[model samples]
Target: MMKIGVIGISGGWSSEQLADAVEKKTGFRLIVDFENLLLDLDTGTVWSGGVDLSSLDALMVKKIGAQYSPALLDRLDILRFLQGKGVPVFSPPDRIMGVLNRLSCTITLRNGKIPMPPTIITENVDLGLKAVETYKEAVFKPMFSSKARGMEVISPGLGAREKIENFAKKHGMMYIQKKIDFGRQDLGIVFLGGRYLTTYARCARGDSWNTTIRSGGEYKPFDPSLELIALAQKAQSLFGLDFTCVDVAQTPDGPVVFEVSAFGGFRGIHMARGMNAADLYVTYIQEQLDKGLITY
Candidate 1:
């Protein structure tokens, strides 16, 4: 039997969902709340306490949460161990970190030649204020955030400048951008196995920016733009990601790249698209398993 670890922070909704999907689609059992496999570097043995990492074929990393500890070094060490061995880790660790940083992602989009709104990563209040003044609108977001959390929209007379400064002081630097004027519309494109599974939804009646479950934003299937398809493909290639959720804004100027999520919101996208996305992900894992790929 081949084992594939479905990882999250012990137990999270998304993790549970993915585990179920993998079991159903690929016949890989879920190992929740247990460290089934262990590697003794000194002894050069991989054991499941009783089992072994050699028994595992792949790993679906569903959640990579915020780590504010110096222990992040230890976390990276474990990731490197598993990956270096040969286990096919879905949404590989390096790509996950790459998509999490706002500034790095901006550079990625530019390098990939993807269309996006003007953006700046700065701690200087003057520059942030100036961008808002020039464009008459802008958005302030943490370098690492999810689900439209910690997102803000700036407009003239909205007292957004001070807000940006205060936010920066507390949360490191921010990614500020001239707000896209799309009139309450946004797009989320999920790419798995180098294919686009797109969805469209409004920003919830009065909301201008965020359209997440917390904000009561509903989802529906919609056609994707040629540009969107192209950008999504380019982004996946650049990240070398097996899966991602790319958010885009429909601005008056054009579609703007909002952000790319590595452990992107899989539940909602899977539910809304109803294209069996989880199964697709499991299929990828299954392929890795069938190939008998195991690092440990």
Candidate 2:
């Protein structure tokens, strides 16, 4: 049988259970819970988790959480090393920074002519303040963040400059967007294994500006038009994402993509579409193995 692994911390929830379920249903040998693995040089070979990690056929990254103790570089190098050895690794670690960093993602999007709201990226509080003055309102974001955490709205004469200074002092950079009035709602479309998986609408609850579950967002199923799918897929292709969720919002002109998430949770899609995205992911891996995409 083919072998695979999920390199992530067991969340004490369905992430682990889901891995087990996929193993049982797919008949693939799986190694779950490979986080915090020790990397050591054994006669010039790097071994992690007390085993040769490159032995696996393929690795599906369920989590790549930021590391401090082990150093993020160490974690990233592990994946690159595995891929270099011809073990198929989903979402190559090398490609991650370019896609995850807001500034880099924006550059790629614009270069690819992907439609999105105007953005101002800077370490300068003065530039951010000017952006708010010009655009009426701007949304400030950390270069690396998710779940809408640390997101701020810059309104004119509202001490926005002071806020940007404080933010820059901490994050050292900012990704600010001219807030597009999407009317409290946005669409999140999921793509898996280079295929469309599902789409849903996330609405902010009770006047909250953020449409994230962390910010009291609710989801419902929505069938997207071809134009929307094409747009999301275009973003996905630009990122070379094996799996992702594309966040899109509708402006007065048309739909504009705001973000493409590298690690997306599928609870909302499961709730609305009654589909287990986890299953599709495992199936995709099996199909790849069958096609000999994951080399030994």
Candidate 3:
């Protein structure tokens, strides 16, 4: 039997679902939490809950941390080290590293000519203020964030400067982007193995600025046009992740990408499309391992 481990947060919905799927397939279940992980450099061993992570036949990253933080980068470094030791990590740690930070993902997308909202990155309060003024309304995003957390929408008016300053104080580097009017919904276009898998929409409830689930958004099945799917495919292809979701918003001009997710949500796909993404993903991983496609 293959011993495959899922690196994720304990008690996390998606994490647990993935572990269950893996267990069903391989009869071995291990949910490796980064918080409980210990790496002994001298022995070149990664120990977590008395299990040697480097001994696993393959590893899948479901989630690195419970919340997004700079510390997640350090956790990924450990995964990279394991990969170097010949354990095939799904999606590869280096590829995930490229998309973990907002700035790095933005740079890659922009360079690929992917359509995105006008964005500005700076540590200067004055520049951030200017960006707010230029765009009229801007979204202040942390470099490391997910599900619209640590994000604030600031309109150009009274207290704009103070808002920018306060945000900059909290996050040394400010990522300001022109807030596009995406109506009440945005699309989560999923891709598995670099191919389009499915699409879902997060419909906003109440008057939230973003359509994240935490902000009272609900997931619904969506049928996207070919153009939209192509755009999302292009954006996700830039990262080459084994599994990912491209957040795209339809604007007056065209569709613009928000970001490529490092670990795509399984709940949304399940709730909206009635598909078992965890089962599908586990099957894909098994097929890859059987074909010798996943290699160190």
Sorting all predicted structures by lDDT, with the top scorer first, yields: 3, 2, 1
Model 3: per-residue Cα lDDT over 1-296, one tens digit each: 99999999889999999999999989999999987899999999999889999999999999998788889889888999999999999879999999999999999999999999999999999999899999989999999999999999998889999998899889999999999988999999999889899999999999898999999999999999999999999999898999999999999999999999978769889999999898999999999989999744
Using lDDT as the measure, the top candidate is 3
Decide which is better by TM-score, 1 or 3: 3
For candidate 3, the 10 contiguous residues with the lowest summed lDDT are 287-296
lDDT of 2: 0.75
Over 123-209, each residue of candidate 2 has an lDDT whose tens digit, in order, gives: 888887888898898888877677787788878886778887888898777788988888888998999876888898888898788
Total backbone clashes of candidate 3, pairs 3 or more residues apart or in separate chains: 0
115-134 in candidate 1: lDDT tens per residue?
88888777788877887788
- Model 3 alpha-carbon miss at residue 242, Å: 0.3
Clash pairs (backbone) in predicted model 2:
none
Worst 10 residues of 1 by lDDT: 67-76
Better of 2 and 3 by lDDT: 3
Kindly report which residue stretches of model 2 are placed more than 4 angstroms away from their true locations once superposed. Answer: 12-14, 26-35, 42-51, 66-74, 294-296
Note the Cα lDDT for every prediction shown: 0.68, 0.75, 0.93
